[model samples]
Target: MSKPVTDRLLTALQAIQESQGAVSDTALKALSQARSEPLYRLEGLRSFYPVFREIAGAPHRLQICRDGPCRLKGQALAADLQVALDGRQDLDIEMVSCLGLCDCAPASALNETPGPLPDASTVIEWLDNAHWPIPVATNNLQRLPTDPYPGVDCRYGAIKAWRDRPAEDIIREIEAAGLQGLGGAAFPTARKWAFTRAASGEPRTVICNADESEPGTFKDRHLLENAPHLVIEGMLLGGVVIGASLGVIYLRHEYHQARRRIEEALATARGSGVLGPDARGPGLAFDIELFVSPGGYILGEETALLEALEDRRGEPRHKPPFPTTVGLHGGPTLINNVETLAAVTTILARGASWWRAQGRGEHAGLKYICVSGDIKTPQVLCLPWGSTVAEAIEGCGGLSDGRNLLAFSPGGASTPFLPPTAADTPMTFDDLRAAGSGLGTGALFVVGTGRSLADVLLAQAHFFRNESCGKCVPCRVGSAKGVEMAESALEHSPAPIEQALETLHHTLSRTSICGLGQVALLPLVDGLRRFPDEPSLKPLKGFTTGAD
Candidate 1:
C-alpha cells in the first residue's frame, strides 16, 4: 500500500483544513505537539499560507487578486467592495497579489473555494447574506485534448509508457528530446534529473511546482484543470528515472478549482492502478501527494517552496549545495515546473523528431502564451517558437477596440517592458533579453493607450514590496524604498528618482538572495529606460546630500 498523504506535513495540514474551514492555531499546536516538534515550526508553516489563520475571528476570509492584469479591471472593483464591507468585523478582506486568473479579472477566494470568476459582482449577495454561490465545475477534464501528452493515452498513458523502462533509457529519451524547464529559468530538464539520479540519498524526491503565482501567468492552471493526468504521468516518469518513490505537487491555495480537480484526478488515477503501491510491479513503491500554499510571492522560489512543504517558514536556501544534492529533508530531490513536466510526457512518447517538427527555427516546440490587459480577446495560446510579440497581440484580436499599442511586458511582471517600437521583436529567450526583457513564462501584458505607465509601475512595486519574504536586506529594504519612490513620482516629474534608483537597482541586483529583489529593480529601471522623457521629478537641489 502507498503511504497515506497525511503522513506528510503538507497533507496533514490539508487534513486539518478539510475538516475545518480554516487551519487555526489550535490545530497547528496539536499537530506540532503530537509530532514532538517545536511549536515555532508549526507556526512557521501555518503563517505563510494566506488561507490559514492564527486567530480565527471570521467565518469566511476573502482574498482578491491585485496583480497587474487584474489591476486593469479589478482594482477599482475591489476598492468599491472594500468600502461596502468596511467596519464589518465579521469578514476579512485580503488582497492577494496574483490569483493566476487574468482571464477572469476580479477573481477571489472565499474561504477555501475559488470564485466570483464571471460573477465577481456576486460578492454583494455574499456580503448581504454571507452566502456564496456553489463553486463552478473545476473537474472539466473533457476540456483537455484526448491525447494531450501524445503516445500515451491521457487516461492510462503513463502506466503504459513506463512498462518498467530502465532508468538509463528513460533518462536518455528525455535528453534527446532537448526538453527544458518551462518556468522562466528554462534550465535543461534532463540535466536536472541526471544530477538527482546520481546524488547520494535514500528515498529521493520529485517536487512539481503548480503554484502559478507569477503575475500574468496562468497556462499551468488551464493544463491542471483540463489535463492533470498528463502532469501526473510526467511525475511518474521522473520518479522512475531518478529512483524516486515520492512525488508531491505543491499547488496554490487560491486556485481552489484547480486544486479540487487535481485531487479528484489523483484519487481516480490510484483507483485505476496507475499510482500507489504495486504501481510499478510487486516490490517498487512510488506515489504522489498534493500540497497547497497559504500565500506569498516569494514562496514560488523552489527552496522556499520546499521549506513550506516541510512545515517551516518559506525562505530561499543558500546556494552551492543546491536542491538536487541537499533538498527536502536533506535527500536528493528533483524540482520542476508543471508545464515542464507536462511537456516531458509528450516528448518521450512522440520522440524528439516530433518536437523538432513543431518548431519553425532554432526556437523549437510550442509555448503557452497568456495574453491579457487591454486586448480584444484575452486568452491563453500555445504558439510555436519564433513568434513575434506583434503576432501574439494580433492573435488576441489586435488590441481592444483597435487602440494603438502602448508599452507591454513580453513575459510576466518580473521582466522589462518594451515600447511599441519593439512590437515586432520575436519572443525567443535570447531576443527578449537583447531587447531588455525576457520571455518570462511566455506571457504578454500589453498596456493599452489609456493606461498610465506610472500607475502600472507603482502597482508592480506594491506587489514586490508586499510579497518580499523579508529574508535579505536588499529585497526587504529595497522593495519598500522602491514603493516610496514610485508613489512619490507617479503624479510629478520623474527626476527625484534618477540617482536614487540607479544605486538602488545595482544594490538590489548584486546583494539580493533570489530573483524577487533582482527582478523588482526592472520596473523602475526599465520604465525609465523605455520612456526617458517622462515628466521629471522635482529636483532635490535644496536638500543636503548624504555620503554614498
Candidate 2:
C-alpha cells in the first residue's frame, strides 16, 4: 500500500477525469510533484498507455471498443461516431480494444469511463450531456459454486473457514484441490503460491487479474458483477499464505460494473474484519486493493502488468526471474486470474474431494467456460472438465437455428479455430493443449458453417497486429505481415499460408519474449492444418523461409 509512482499518477488521473472528463494541466503538474519526477519523465509515462490522454483543452474524448466482439458488429459504431464527430474539433475519438463489454456488442466509454453504448442514441446523449446511463445491479449472489443458482447459503464461508486455520494448512487444501491458473498458462495454482512463499523477499504481494479483455470472454465480468466476494476471499486467503500485506486487483477499464462491485466487496470485507490488520489471525497483516489497467493488450501478461503497475509502459520483461520469484515493485508476488481465485475460494470452503468429483479423468473440476458467438443464447456455464465442446454449446440451446458450428476458438482469440471434428475433444487444460489449443480463460467463440476460415484468421491477424507491444520484432512485424497476407489472399493467391506461419513460428517461438508472439502460433498453424481449403489464404512464393 506504499504510494508508488503508479498509484500516484492513477489517483491524480482518476480524480481529474471524474471531475473534468480529461487529465488537465494542473492535475498533471500536481502528479509530477506528487511523484517528485521531472515533467518529461511524467510525459513519457502518460504517452506510454494508449488510453492515457494529454487532454489539451479538448471538450471530450470518445473511446470505442475495436476488439473482436465489437468488430463482429462491423464498423457501424465507429462510422456513426465519425459522422457525429465530423467537423467537431472539440471532440477527439479513438478506436481502442476490448472494453470488457463484449456481452453488449459495440461498446464504448466516455472519457476514461466504461459503459455499454448499445446504440447511436446513447452516444448522442453522451455527446450532448457528457454522461451516460449505468445498468442496475440486480444479480444478488446467493449461490456458491457447488449448488445451482442461489446455491448453498454459505455467504463468505471461505473467509470464515480460514479465520482460525494456519496459513500452511490453507495452502495445503488449495494444492489438494488440483486447481490450476485459469489465465491461459494453466500453471498449478498451489505451486505458484508455494514459490512466492519460499522466495526471498519482505512484504510479499498478491494480485487479482480481472483485466479480462480477450474477445468473446466475458465470464470474468459475470463473476465480478455477481460473485465479487468469491474472488476477494481467494485473494485474502492467498495473501495470508504468502505473508502479503498488500494485494491488488489489476482490473480492465472497460468493466465499470465489475469495478463498482469489487469496490463494494472490498468495503464489506474490511467492515467485516476479513481484510485489514490480521485478517486471518494475529500478526497476519493482509488487505486487497484494485488497480485499473490503462488499456493495452500486452498488459495481460503478468510481468508486463507489473511493469505498468510500477508506472511504466505495459511491456514484457525478460525472464529467468519470473513473477513468483521477483515481482510487483520488486517483491515476491503471486497473480491469479479472476476465475482461478474464485475457484480457490470454493475449493477452500468445499474440500478437494468434492471438487475432484465434478470432472472426469484428466479434467478434475468445473470449468467456467463462456460459450458465445453464433449461439441462440450466449452464456457462462460451469461445465464439468472433460466435457465435450459440443456439450457445452448445447447447454445454452445449441447454435442459432440451422447454423452448424464450423469452427471455434476453444479458449478466446488466442486459441486455434478447431473444426467440428475437434468439438468432440475434451475441454480440459491438458486435453485442449493436446488438441492444439489451450483452455485459455475458458472462453469459446463458435463460428457458424460456411463462414470463411480465412476471414476469421484475417480478423485475428488484425487483432494481434494492432495490439502487439512492439517490444520484439517477430511479433510486431510478423503480426503486421500476417494481416497483409490475409488481406492479399482475399483477392489473390501467392504463397502457401501454412509455410509463412511455420516460418514465423520458428522465428518468434521463443525469441519474441512473451505470449504475444507465442499465441499467434495457435490460430495460424491450426488454421492451415484444420482449415486447408480456406480461400482467404493465398499461395505465394518468397513469403516463407527458403525451405518451404
Please give the CA lDDT of all the candidate structures.
0.76, 0.74
Clashing pairs in 2: 143-151, 494-539, 494-540, 495-539, 495-540
Once fitted onto the true fold, the runs of candidate 2 whose alpha carbons sit more than 4 angstroms away are 4-7, 24-30, 56-62, 75-93, 110-154, 491-497, 538-548
Query: Which candidate gets the maximum lDDT versus the true structure?
Result: 1
lDDT of 1 by residue, 276-380 (tens): 776666666778988777667787899998788666778887886888998888888899988888888777767766776676677667777888888887777
Single out the weakest 10-residue window by summed lDDT for candidate 1: 539-548
Candidate 2 lDDT over residue span 1-548, tens digit each? 54443455655565566576556567678878976877776676666676555564556666777766566554566787678666766567777766666655556766556655545566667667766564422243444454322432456677777867777777788788888888888889998988888898755888988877777788888888888888888888888788788888988876777788889989988887778787867877777868877777788889888887876778899997998888987889889989999898878777888888889875678888887667776767888888999898888788875888788888988888888888888888778889887788788888787555666666776777788888889888877776676566455545556677677767776678898787665576668777655544433332322232
| Candidate 1 residue pairs that clash | 49-294, 50-294, 50-295, 493-536, 493-537, 494-536, 494-537, 495-536, 495-537
- Model 2 scores worst on lDDT over the 10 consecutive residues at 539-548
Candidate 1 to truth, TM: 0.90
